[model samples]
Target: MIKTIIFDFGDVFINLDKHATEKELLKLGLPSITEDLEYINESYETGKITTIDFINYYQKLLPDVSEKKIIDAWNSILKDFPKHRLKFIQKLSENKTYLLILLSNTNELHIDWIKENVPFYNNFKSCFNFFYLSHEINLRKPNHDIFRFVLDNHQLNPVETLFIDDTFVNTNTAQELGINIWNNDPKKEDITNLFTIKSNLF
Candidate 1:
């Protein structure tokens, strides 16, 4: 039986324009995403670099873009958190039917934006038994080690844990580690229908 649920934040909870950042950067005269840019992003996501360094790296690349512009473009991906989803999770938390954990590959800048914009961020956070932010935890997903860290730290059995993520890559890694998964398509699926949609698994 699935006794625990691990949820990814972006697209799964807060909506995201997956292509917004790339498009914004391109508009800012970023030629294309380079290997170095990807490395810098991954490093920032994993808390290997500071927010100041992250912004500076981009500023150095797009010399004409101001720090505020760089930050705005980077955060353009984040969208609104729907009220129904918050209610669903809050109800789920109240019932205590399963151990609810939130695991997100997020950085400081995005989080700061959410704190300022999402009025219920704190309420949403309070629903989770454990909240794991990649930058805070020094780990990011699609990496097997991060999944293992969650399991080990929570003393959770992989077989009894269900991982839900909008990204197939992330769910795939957890599946290989023996966790049940739902590779949710944000366009077609809403997490509020979790039990109805993944009824067989539950």
Candidate 2:
């Protein structure tokens, strides 16, 4: 019996063009997505660095690119939050059937953009018993520690928890810890169909 539900914010709830940032960066003369760049991104997501530092790092890498352009390129991955998904989660919350939690590997700028764009962000947040932003928590997913932290903090049994994420790596890590997972494919699957799609788990 899944008593708790953990959801990934990107793709799983709010839509995201996962490759948009890389594409935008390339247009801005990023050269290529190097290992160093990936490290910086992971650090930023885990709150290891400040927003200013993140922008500065990019600025140094691409001196000709303006700060505004860099910021825009970075946020290009975000997309609209569909109303139907919001309604489904809201209805699910109203039922109060499970301990709902949201865990997302997000940074400051992206969240600021979401706050400005997503009108029902507050209402959506209220639906979850716990809401954790990776930067705020200093923990990002696909990391065993983050999953373990959530399980330990809430006294949740991994066997009784279901984690839904669009990333295979994240779901794989969670599954290794004995947590049930739904590796949702954002392209082909809609989160609103969660019950019908993963009805066997319930």
Candidate 3:
């Protein structure tokens, strides 16, 4: 009875090197991941701070690192987006079998990079009936409010909505709210195998 599908964008669609950014930052003199740094990142992800401010904070921390280098390091987390996934989503969209929704906790810089690097980014976006970006909406995942916002906005039944995310915490939150979930492991699973992997849901 799953009528609406909510998908995460990172790993679930575009490949991401979750550790790449921190590794790259270390190369530019970042000592270690600190509490303040995590706060800043979460703030940026939720649009609590502007991009210019984000870069400036890093510049202040690593005075020797140039703006361009910092930007490059930050964006290093993004990787190749396989076309097969695009085709899968596109085909699903054409069939209109479910109410497709994309709910991602992505920042502006990463999205800009995707638009520039992923040739079919726009087409992929169009496949979704609703596209919600964290920074754009001032909300990030693993939080109850954000999930509620989507459910309320769409008037969707939690039992009839399936949420798929690479992160367990995100899926966990949705499950707590009564939504069906798939906490996909990007290393072993591809979203193209969705129906087979979670066949019972279909």
Candidate 4:
């Protein structure tokens, strides 16, 4: 009955160091990531703020950290893209067994980072029918509103929509909305190996 598949980009598609950027920030010596900084990040994700503005705002916190260094360090979180996983999603997309969609709670800095670092970023994103980013949509995951937004917008039946994410918190939110969910471990499990067929997906 599954007719739609929602994929989370970080752990689901690309290799990302979950804690790398935050650790780098702490090392850079900010008193802490401030509320204003969090606002800038949220604003960036919703497309309400520009990427440059977000970088500049965060830079002010670390007066000594050059913009270029901050940018590089921020982007370091997105490590690499495994070729086989790309091929798996590509193949799954071609078969058209489900309405393939992608959803991620990502910000402008990350988007710009991927644009410059991942040569095939755009092409790979094109594989999805509706690729939704929290910053663009002004909605983030682990929040029920975003989950509901996707379900309502697509006229999707949650029972038939499988949501896969590395974050149990996000998937759990979707699960509460009646969406089928899979929480996979990036270190121990990969989605490419998770699904030989969507029917038997975890």
Candidate 5:
């Protein structure tokens, strides 16, 4: 029997852009996805850098871009959160048959947006016993170490864990570690209105 339910934050619960941020960044003449920006983002999330310092770094790199504009663009990936999914999660949590957990690779900027916009964010957090993030854990998905960290730290039985994520490589890696996985391809797999377990939830 499945003992734990693990969910990915971006696509599993909240809607995320397929490539909107990179597209918007590209429009800003930053074609290479700036190592500086990525570093500052990851670093900030891990507590290696402060939010103000990260903002300053971005400002230093893109002198012409306003701080507000850059921040807005950075958070633009958070487009929507379907209410039906929330209802489903609520229903599942109400059942209380499994240990509910969340594992997501997210940065500070996105989190700030969630705090500001999602009124149910606190309730969602309360529904899970464990909520892990790449930045906080200093490990990211698609990396075996992170998956191992989650499983070992939680004392989870791989066979009894079902991990849901939007990224194929992430799901692929978890599957390799013996955890049942679901690759939630939005174009092919619509989880927004899910109620019952389907053959292809994976």
Candidate 6:
């Protein structure tokens, strides 16, 4: 039986253009998505660097790109948070059937943008029994340690926990830790259909 539910914030809840950031960066004169750039992004997501340092790195690399422009480009990947999804989560929270947890691999800037843009951000956050953000926790998904931390922190049994994420890499890691997983495809899968789609697990 599933006693706890862990959800990913990105595609699973809010829609993301995943490629929008890269496209916007290209427009802002980023030559290509290099390994070094990926490293810097991951470092920022892991809270190894400050927001100023992140923007400074971009400024130094793309000298012509303004700080505001770089920030915009970086945040372009974020899109809308549909009301239906919020309602779904809200209903789930009201029922109080399972221990609801939100686990997201996100940086500070993106979160700040969400808080500013998403009108019901605080209400959505309150739906979760516990909310864990990567930068705030110094941990990101696809890392075994993060999965362990969540489980250990809640004293949750892996066999009775279900982790839903849009990323296969993250779900794969959670599965290895013996948790149930739904490696959802955002293009075709809507998280509101959780029970219908994965009924056998329940």
List TM-score per model, in order. 0.98, 0.98, 0.99, 0.91, 0.88, 0.98
Per-residue CA lDDT of candidate 3, range 1-118, in tens?
Answer: 8999999999999999999999999999999989999999999999999999999999999998999999999999999999999999999999999999999998989999899999
lDDT of 4: 0.84
Residue 29 deviation, candidate 2, in Å? 1.3
Q: Tell how far residue 146 is off in model 5, in angstroms.
A: 1.6
- For residues 1-202, write the lDDT of model 6, one tens digit per residue: 9999999999998999999999999998888999999999999999999999999999988999789999999999999999999999999999999999999999999999999999999999999999999999999989999999999999999999999999989999999999999999999999999999999998
1-202 per-residue lDDT for model 2 (tens digits): 8999999999988999999999999999989999999999999999999999999999998999999999999999999899999999999999999999999999999999999999999999999999999999999989999999999999999999999998899999999999999999998999889889989889
- In model 3, residue pairs whose N, Cα or C atoms come closer than 3 Å (at least 3 residues apart or on different chains), thus clashing, are none
RMSD of 5: 2.4
TM-score of 1: 0.98
RMSD of each: 0.7, 0.8, 0.6, 2.0, 2.4, 0.7
* Tens digit per residue, CA lDDT, model 1, 1-202: 8999999999999999989999999999999999989999999999999999999999989999899999999999999999999999999999999999999999999999999999999999999999999999999999999999999999999989999999989999999999999999999999999999999977
Full-model lDDT for every candidate: 0.96, 0.95, 0.96, 0.84, 0.80, 0.96
Error of 4 at 33 (Å): 3.0
Of 1 and 6, the candidate ahead on lDDT is 6
Query: lDDT per residue, candidate 4, 1-202, as tens digits?
Result: 7889899999877889978887888888867767777777667777788887878787778889998888777777898888788788888889988899999988877887888878888778978999998888888888899999989998999998999998989988999999998887888888887565344643
Which residue pairs show collisions in model 2? none
* lDDT of model 1, residue 155: 95
lDDT of 3 at 104: 94
Model 2 C-alpha lDDT versus the unseen true structure:
0.95
